[model samples]
Target: MASVDLATSYAALILADDGIEITADKILALTEAASVEVEPIWASLLAKALEGKDVKELLSNIGSGGGGAPAAAASAAGGAAAAAAEAPKEEEKKKEEEKEESDEDMGFGLFD
Candidate 1:
């Protein structure tokens, strides 16, 4: 079985909703069939859904397995992708810092 990344699956659903009516059961089944962890993706989707009026109720509905509006889900997926991209920058920065420390320990500077 081909494995689907949860984020990608959620994003796909968000896009699909643009042309068709998406239901909670369909979303749940997609996530489950993907054979990957989807809790984080679901949480992100829920956050987007709650951005409107009655956050508590909105979130409660989402938590109870209700599908969010297409636009909201798409927005959430975009946000998650942006956030995921930042993670690489952080890792790169950490690596650079470690390299600089190692160089310093060796008494080597760019000028040296």
Candidate 2:
């Protein structure tokens, strides 16, 4: 698809999720004026949606009628999933270390 179409599709998804309901023509015009690539714009919108919402919401917003290169969407999803998964692992490791420290302190009867 043309860059304009991709931009419009991305904008439509964003607007729908935000309840803005803007026209595709407006989106095309804005993207053309900004000269930014459609993939980046779509990625940004997806990121924003993910911030205050769940993955299901984000997927529903962008799953249908959203237009961008398929490869871009796939890569973006993969990257986001990897990052989200890693975040929990890191948090768990930190919690484990904290727990160990707490156990050591209790063993010393520091609180008593």
Candidate 3:
């Protein structure tokens, strides 16, 4: 797909999820704010495509479809699944360390 098309679609998704009305104007505004350089036609097409659609339902259905390019890329990269599985353990350890540091109070005070 064209880069403009991709940008417009993602902008539409964000607007929908935020409960904002999806329009070419809104999509263009978002893309412009992000410095995406999208064509006007792409935003208009996405707006029409999303008309009368429930954003939350569409997002849920998209998640359910599963196994797209990201999974394929991870497999191609080798051992990505193992790394991903280890991520939560690393996060838990970091959180525990942070809790311990916060408990020390470091001689700081609310008014100091």
The TM-score leader among the candidates is: 3
Instruction: Report lDDT per candidate.
Output: 0.56, 0.59, 0.82
Model 1 regions lying over 4 Å from their true place? 1-76
Q: Which wins on lDDT, candidate 2 or candidate 3?
A: 3
Off by over 4 Å in 3: 63-112
**Preferred candidate (TM-score higher): 1 or 2:** 1
Q: Write the per-residue lDDT of candidate 3 for residues 45-105, one digit (tens) a residue.
A: 8888889999789767886575475566667777976587568779999998897778667
lDDT of 2 by residue, 15-66 (tens): 5566654543445555666685554455455445444544446576875564
TM per candidate comes to 0.31, 0.28, 0.51
The whole-model C-alpha lDDT of candidate 2 against the native structure comes to 0.59
Candidate 3, lDDT over the whole model: 0.82
Mind giving the per-residue lDDT tens digits that candidate 1 earns over 1-112? Answer: 1333444446445635454334444455556665554554554554354334453344358755533454455577897766765787899999999999999999889889
True-vs-predicted CA distance for residue 60, candidate 1, Å: 50
Q: Candidate 1 has what TM-score?
A: 0.31
| By lDDT: ranked, best first | 3, 2, 1
Q: State the displacement of the C-alpha of residue 4, model 2, in Å, after optimal TM-score superposition.
A: 72
Residue 80's lDDT within candidate 3 is 75
